[model samples]
Target: MKHEDEMRRRAGAESIAGGDEAEQLDQDTLIHELRTHQLELEMQNEELQRTELELIEARDRFTDLYDFAPVGYATVSDKGLITQANIMLAEMLGVDRNRLIGQRFSHFIMPQDYDAWYLLIVKLFRLNLRQQTELALKCEDGSICYAQLHCLPVCSAQSNAIRITFADISEYRRIEAEKRQYEEQCRSLFENMLDIYYKTDMDGRIEVVSPSCLAQTGYTQAELLGRRVTEFYIDPAQRDQLLSALLRKGKVNDYELILAHKNKAPRIASATCRLLRDEAGKPVAIEGVLRNITARKQVEEQLRLSETRYRALFEQTSDYVLVMEPRTDAAPVIVDANQAAFEKHGYAADDLIGKPITFIDTNISPEAVAERMRLLQSGDPVYFETKHTCSDGSTFWADAVARYVSIGDSNMIYSVERDATRRKQAEEDQARLLRENRALMRQLMQVQEDERRTLARDLHDELGQLLTGIQTRGEYITMHAIDSEVRIMGEEIVRSTSALFDASHASLLRLRPATLDALGLSAALTELTGERQKQADIVCSMRIDGDIDALDDMRAIAIYRLVQEGLTNAFRHGKADCVNVIIRKLPAHAGRDDQLWIEITDNGKGVHAEADRTPTGMGVIGMRERVHALGGTFMLTHVPEDGVRIEAMLPLDHSEDSGR
Candidate 1:
């Protein structure tokens, strides 16, 4: 303050100066403030420029991510129009990206999924929440797209939209469906298969078994599972064999075993098994299918027993038995033979087997054997009589019965033969004896006829002359004597002589016909037939055609005797009227000799029921012998209503010089 007075005048001058300084200072401060504000403005401009560049880069990255993403992206307006869509979304719809804008999103959705899409969009927009759904989308090409979609509502004050993203799930769905189907098929096969399916651990414990196991093994599935597989085996060693085969070969096919049922009955089974292994190839379990073969096994055993019995019978029988296999290129060959066959053929077993049947058969040819085989194809048994040759070249007859048979898969002919040689020899001996007997009988008959002819000649020549001289002397005495007693005596003597001569003549004719020696057989037959007609009061007709008179005396005598005997039988036994006799000669033809045919037919009573008139009687027997002695055939037919017809055919070439 004191300095204020003294400085008042100085202060005024200082104040002016101070004021100027203050003003200059204030201006400098203001300039500095301006420079700072300008720097801040420049910095703000640089920051804005950098932020714009970053925003542009972010927009480009988002566009690329949205357009090229694996999943499809789309934006839909509240009206369900496709407001925006990415390249992936266009490709998913099989459409161009630019053309996708402003299209109704529901148009691309499958008609079946339209309601679902509508509900999803409504739920998203109304709840302002995210929604998920599966939809089948229709593409521009009209193909379905199985898609899993995720939707988000994009809402603002200006407009409402839904953002959607989807991925193709068709392949995943297909794989899942296939897995379900395969599992179902496996379950059905296990339950319904007829063969038993089983799984067992390495330690022989059953782990899994099918329902069919109960039917085959007579045990329930519950009883089988978790049990030792060897427990059911009748012989435990069989299980060991099965395991060994499975382990060594990794599999076994049709391995047979015997198992015991719960009731202790035997069960025959055939198993096809496989060894199950882990990825590292270590054995883990065994899986198999088992089939019940008990019935089949029983049938096989019965067949075996039957075959054994058949073989025994074949070896022990007395008849020869052979098995032959037929062929197309050659004759049948013997494949097997019984002991009897080898003994009968005089051959060893090795020599006869595999040889052709023709080797032993003397009567068969290869061509004939082939024909027989062809006939056997009809499955009929063939019976035949055949001749067989032995090792010593002797032959024998055999009665053979052959049958076509099938053994296993081979076609065979089985033959049973019996020796018939003795029977054939006996038949031949009998025929020879019959011929000899016939020849001797003919010789005896010829001797008897010769005796009759000699007796007849003696009676006619010697007795006839004596009787005639006596008769003439008696007649002369009667005519010349004068005494009454002498005349009477002469008459009586002449009468007695005449009566004796007539009786002697009648005896000669009865013993042997005089006409037979004088005339031929035809004339003698005529006289005998005429005499029979008069005696029996029957009509007898005769017809003779041949040169029969030229025959030898024996033949002529035979003809005469036959005619006389025939007339006597007709008059006595036949007791009828008309009789016909015919004799004719037939010319030779077709390698036959000239023959004489004789037929005698009579209208008579034929044969009597008493059997005395049978061919065994003396009269019929003599006639048959006479015809047979001359090597002729004789037939006599008797009809009760008609007549009796006798016919004889004699071969002329068969003379007595040739043995009958």
Candidate 2:
């Protein structure tokens, strides 16, 4: 019971104490503290929101810079995994930005670059330093791009990441390609000289040429570019022939041909053609070189013509032409001889071609032969005569000539022998005949002059005496008769006789024309024209056109006779006519008077067809000879309608002067 009472008392005390503790907490202001704590929490939340907003703005800026940078930027983990990639890097790799993240870096490397990349990664990790490498990256499109990459290794106690940057190398590759191509062109240009060069399009056309081609073909590059090779060749078919040869043997040799150009001048060329081939070994075009052989061809032609002419002259000479070799003694040997030699010496060419000259002449002096051989060797000409023996053992005189000649680039002697036997005989015979002919001509001229003198004496001396007797007798009879009628009759008879004698004297004078000597030729010509005009009852005049000082007496005489004869012809044959005679001094030569011209023209019935139709008529022949003998010209023509013209130009101061 006491224990129970104590426990209860203790319980009552504890309850009072607990109540005091609670009163103390209440007294310490519990609501105020709770409110203060709430206010503090609200303020902290507002400050946290403001800090979050600032962080968001800064993160956005960083993302923009990383994705859009000019060069690619990426973050890789130490395990060769790409943890972050910017937009540029993703594009370079041909992938989405998000897709490239968390990808193994080795997966993006080309197979060719994988080993090199492994080495680079090892260096980056071991040294923990910056590293660079050129890598070919395989993109998602299955294309490769070269890249220069720089990696910054960021290593820490807790993190594994490498910061890497990449640069595209497209422009660098382009420049490198250009440099290599230039070097290749220079090498080809140097090594390919002395050969034909060419370029072709996809078609089998030659599109470019070298300067050597122009020199070879004589055509410009522009001329040949569009033209086929066949067009310029003399033979168009040669192109196909060359093609066939190339297809069979893969090349053609330096073949000879006469080729014609577009202008048609023939050229000789040595040609070598080769195939221009493609990668497939098919021939796409042809390339060739041509060497000009025109000058060589010209030389060959000249040599041929020279050979032909000389051979013909040597073989067919009427003189005994021979080709001889010089001998040490006796005589030079005749290697060849012509037909004339055979006829001259009575030996065939076959007998002489290889024989020494002494074979034809047994008495030829060895000294003479030796001298001739020396002269031939010294390049001098040799000519002499020697007695030659015939096949019949008969001897004849022969003349021989030899000279040094060049044949086929070797000095040689050419020899010729002429048979002077027949020529000498003919010359002797001609001298005898000429002497006889001169004697006969002299006798004939003497006879002709004697006959002319006798006839003139008969006409003047004989007939003049007879006519004088008749005139004196008639006058005597007129005086003796006394009756008027008888005397008148006698006077009539005297007058008649006087008229007859006068007519006879005129006739005798006309036969020789005595007045031709006393009067000058021009004066005589004037008298003749007046008489013709009176006798023919035609109107006529004589006129001289130029100075007559150039006329010699003979030419002057010929002119007079020509006018007189022409007018007589006009009166006799050409009826119903008028006449004109003209004389002039013709153009001169060597400061001397040249020709004296006489032109006698008449308006008459003109020359008959019988007279002029034949070029050689009697009158015309005489006139032409008179002019031609003086080395002058004579021309005769019938004027178209009513007249004839006889023109004679006689050289003055000719031998026909002085009555010769």
Candidate 3:
């Protein structure tokens, strides 16, 4: 203000001194100019002060933005030293702003990143370009953090520096690493999995296929890409169906269909698919997985065929079939029955189902049924014959076969029954006929024995008397004859009569053995053996185990006849040189009498093979008939290298009672 006052006084004096007319005018003008200039200077000074205040506020705002910003800002010198750092940068380094100044920026970097920082600084200076990199940095506390560094060149009057921005990105980097690892795992699974993974455009054209496509569809991944998905379908329409369903539901699971392999063979596959959408929610592609189901489909088909055949057989078989489920320890409940079972039992299916197994055959006790069920559960099958009562109250014999079967979750019994009523009746009829035949045979044998005895008596008595008289007359004529010729003729007559008597006696003995009738079976066998030995010039032996006298006449006759026939056949047909006969009595069995066993063996040439092949002759047949008539069994066998043997067994008690 003083200077301004002084300058004002001086300007006033100068202007007054020059105050003549022209001078006074100029001085007034100068004073006016000076006053105008003074006012202008004051206005300008106020404008400048206001402008300076605005600049101070702007600088304050700028400083606040740089120091407290979310990111750290710093200036590094050409020598890689920190020249300036914002409060954020200082905080990031866990150091005071003053402490950070003049510190080597590389020192704040991790040791492992030293070369990277050095290279970054060199590149910034050389290219004066902006660059960004991510690296780890060490804080003042020695803790490490990940940061993204963005560096740009800065030029100032004093020196060249690089301005750098640091962003803390540790959490982001951790998340990125995890995401990469997860993607790698998914890629591995997609490539190596057995199932095929694929992506298709909305037009059903394949855009991506995993490596498994080659093994699953017999098509290379390259061959599949860019091809219409329907091209691999056995029925092209199937793709349309799939798309329609997917459009309706937005996803499909286990949609099964047939696909044509590269070889043109059909393969079954199950697909799980979903629609892929863009950020705008518009459908872009279809992503899916396909699994080969050809083997499972084949197995299902086989099972279906097997079930069909089983049903056919079960319904068509003549034998009655039943399926029953066990009810704990109780009798099994009938669950199913075949056509035969329903018809034979005269019951409707509804009536039989749910009924106990014992219900069909009332004769079987509950305990017995339970026992059979136990056996069946143990994997044992039970077979038995019983009388079964039908729904109509009629009874018939049945043969039942039962076994355990498992169907799904339940254990059941499967039974097959056959009607045996006709068979049983036929067997009874056969037994009756056999008994009647035996009775008639016994009577016929008795009558034949009676006739033989009468013939023997007549031949022995009358024929012997007649031959004796003729012999005596011939002897007298020969003794009293006058001429030699007459005597010689009478001698020839006596010789002829003697020969006739001898032949008659031998014939009577053979027709009816008198010793066999009077003495017993043993004597008859002995005499018969002796005769065969002499007549056939062979050795014959007889063995008797029990007392022959104990046997009744009828039984004795049958025995004698059997023995005689056996010996005759052995000698005539077998051409035997030696014969042995044995008769032994066996002990009695329960409900049976003592049995007699007779065996005849011969040491002669065995019967001819051709004769054995031919039907049995009447002689052997007769022997069998006689033994059968006495309720005995007879067997005739040609032993290899041991001639022929005949065996017979007779029940003594049976023979004795029948005769009486």
Best by TM-score: 3
TM-score of each: 0.50, 0.37, 0.55
lDDT accuracy of residue 217 in candidate 1: 73
Q: Any runs in candidate 2 off by more than 4 Å, and if so which?
A: 1-250, 253-469, 479-492, 545-553, 590-593, 609-618, 655-660
lDDT of 2 at 363: 81
| Deviation of model 1 at 174, angstroms | 27
Mark the regions of model 1 whose C-alpha exceeds 4 Å error after superposition. Answer: 1-310, 318-333, 354-358, 361-387, 395-425, 459-534, 538-571, 574-617, 627-660
Show model 3 residue runs off by greater than 4 Å: 1-215, 221-253, 263-266, 272-291, 294-319, 323-335, 354-387, 397-427, 464-505, 589-593, 606-618, 639-642, 653-660
Better of 1 and 2 by TM-score: 1
Mind giving the per-residue lDDT tens digits that candidate 3 earns over 153-226?
A: 98778889888899989789889999999999998998899999999999998998999988888899989889
After the best TM-score superposition of candidate 3, give how far the Cα of residue 282 lies from its true spot, in angstroms. 14
Q: What clash pairs does model 2 have? A: none
Residue 608 in candidate 2, Cα distance off native in Å: 2.8
Query: Which pairs clash (backbone N, Cα, C closer than 3 Å) in model 1?
Result: none
Q: Is candidate 2 or candidate 3 better by lDDT?
A: 3
In candidate 2, position 531 carries an lDDT of: 66
Arrange candidates by lDDT, highest first: which order? 3, 1, 2
RMSD of 2: 24.8
Summarize candidate 1's per-residue lDDT along 188-265 as a digit string, tens digits. Answer: 988999889999999899998999977777799999989998899999999999999998999999999998988899
